[model samples]
Target: MKRKQPLLLVIIAFFVLSNFIYNVPNIEAATKLDIKAKAAIIIDAKTGKVLYEDNADELLGVASMSKMLTEYLVLEAIHEGRISWDQKVTINEFVHKLSSPYLGLSNVGLTQGEAYTVKELYQAMAIHSANAATVALAEVIAGTEGNFVKLMNEKAAELELGDFHFVNSTGLNNSDMLDNHPEGTDINDENKMSARATAKLAYHLLNDFPEVLDTAKISRLKFRDGRTYNNFNWMLPELTFEYEGVDGLKTGSTNFAGYCFTATAVKSNQRFITVIMNTKSQIERFNETAKLLDYAFANFGEDTLFEKGFVPESKKTLPVTKGKDDSVKIATKDPLSLIIKNGEKDKYKAKLVLNKKKLNEDGQLTAPVKEGDVVGYLTYEYDGDDLGFITDKESTVKVDVVATESVEKANWFVLMMRGIGNFFASLWNGITTTVGGWF
Candidate 1:
């Protein structure tokens, strides 16, 4: 009997262990990326939600990526009528000298005396990353590369690029100083920006002037001189590395700033902007971008939680005090959405939170509630207490809850009638209860 008891105990322990193991939830781990770069960031283009990041705030030379801001300013100028696309710009000796192949800088081979339209120069800067063309366009807008750089810095500040500073319109290293430089030129000045800040700049660039994509997405284009210049961004189809949905953005490299790329890809109405900086080689930059894009598109997507003027079916009515209507319907003032990761939808939850201060002593809203009057907010949560599932990464969007119907104040006669009806109903309920107890 004693030996049998020990065996029985062992069996009981085994079953307990097995039950625990079987019931444990298998939660997938967060996605891990093996990115080989000094700094990197991936963000949703529209919402600016950061999906992935590593050392994204480390300041480093951005090289030709600075030209993106240059391109933005040029586009802004064009839109504001400061410059026209067809307006011809004369190339100065300084531009020609820097563009010379001997200078070891990227150029579209503009001659000192040659004239090109603003459109041609903009294309060269946007697609080919022609430093000379960038400088020429800057000179035309702000009078000098230094002045133009000032505008770039100002705009960067306006955009809240905390870690960005532009030393020159062209992202050329200050070490590459030319003889008899311009008066305001800083021989050692170079553009410095963090990957995070650069992503913000790229976001605004794409949003403000989408026309830049018309030039940026072009894999190749002919200069006014008929010389073909292929885009430096390898993510395009015309280049060796062909990433689907990758259209336009920018690429940068220098002795100081290793291969860097700010890439954007859109698939099924979802767009992502990824920035990789200080990578070892051009191939690695594009490859790392592909990894980031793949991870974003596969795992993360935008989900609209509520549409504009959407009211929750549950608890849609709030009690009204001394009003024509006993209750008022409420709903969200604007659409609410979230960039949820895969497998998180089931964990999503939303609750309508009313403004208690807006209520009277009776715990009901006061009369004269107008439609569209903000009464509270719709708060959303995901897996609030459940760690057994993968949930949103600690992000929430609150939508304004507003009254959907107007409730005018109750008139004196209406208030008297409601009081009399409430008194009679209470008296009848008490009398019925007393009589039933006697029975």
Candidate 2:
């Protein structure tokens, strides 16, 4: 009994340490980050997960953060072979007009007919947030700013960059453009993308054009002469967090938007992309985003929370009926994981727990299906209060359930008739053959 008591005590101690005494490391939370931004958001870049936000859905002028969308379309154009970075873009009168020093735009310094590579324009637009270069690239890619705006809206809709009904690539307050008039007046209540979409946009740009960082990382770049400019963001190595992993993102500010930042940081094998819109000052944006990142690193981590496959224990397996195989197994298309506070794994337990009504027996999609389709959702939940709805409860990721290999072209009406016909024919043939054999 004495020996047993000692063993029980050890077991209890192990559970206590794993579950309680040794909790998830507490990283410094947002410290003295008191600033009144109209909007803000922090996100997990890799998973396209939103971790934090303050009025993230409120639409407001995003300011230079608009550059991220411009960069996204430019890269897409490059990827689709519509344009190349090496291709030279022409500098026109219109392009020259947007390059006002008062506007705080960097210049490409192009003489009429003097050509610069699309690559250089990309750098200018991305690194310097140069208005002239942005217009120049837009002209080259879509042949006009109007056309580029069309493409931008189309792409924005496609990406679901929330609540925007305006023209103009620069999110600068355009008070007079009648095309989509009445821009949301309340900066705190301004039109904006959700933190998830904004973060995803930032995530795409940086991950796609890692080279953009080489230029963005440089705090100053000279243009047109010895004209040197400094980065608008104050969250670099100089601050308290001194986030070494931080690099290459845009910052925004306007009386309405206040001070906003879409920041990307990399630590170990993980990356976090954050957005803070309508902040009080550049320092506030920096420090707030840093705290968000610190919290993410301390709690959540990137690991396969749930993988796509047979549910194993669930009654997930179903009959294929007319398909090639017996039945399809329902599971995740890709694994869902989190960068969550430690022992918060239970929060995920309810997440990976899926609903059957949302799935089909095919384990993929039910019907009216196309290959490479989206079938269900990966729901996540976070019960932690300090982290809020960021890392703990996540945006529902889509689940692509697969259909069986058998392609049944007929709809339900035809399938029913066909099934009946086949059954009757098989029965008739069996009866006739059996009778003949007996005779």
Candidate 2: C-alpha lDDT: 0.62
Model 1 alpha-carbon drift over 4 Å, by segment: 1-30, 177-186, 307-316, 333-335, 351-366, 371-379, 382-400, 412-439
Pairs of residues clashing in candidate 1? none
Q: Provide the lDDT at 4 for model 2.
A: 100
Clashes of each: 0, 18
Taking the tens digit of each residue's C-alpha lDDT, what string does model 2 give over 298-417? 765765556754242443544444444445444556666656555656655433344466456644334433443433445555555544333232454434444323334445677787
lDDT digits (tens) for residues 1-439 of candidate 1: 9879989999999999999999886553345588999999888887677778889889998999989999989999999999999999998887888888787788888898888999988999999999888889989999977778778889998877789878887788866747533346567767889998899899889888988888889999887677888899988986899899999799999988999999999999898999999999988999999999999999889887777887877778889988999999888998888777877777777677878889877779989899888888886767733321111332345788999989999999999999999999999999999999999
Winning model by TM-score: 1
What is the TM-score of each predicted model, taking all chains together?
0.81, 0.64
Alpha-carbon lDDT, every model: 0.85, 0.62
lDDT of candidate 1 at residue 193, scale 0 to 100: 97
Identify the runs in model 2 with alpha carbons over 4 angstroms from their true place: 1-35, 102-110, 175-197, 206-215, 236-242, 304-311, 315-336, 350-439
Top lDDT model: 1
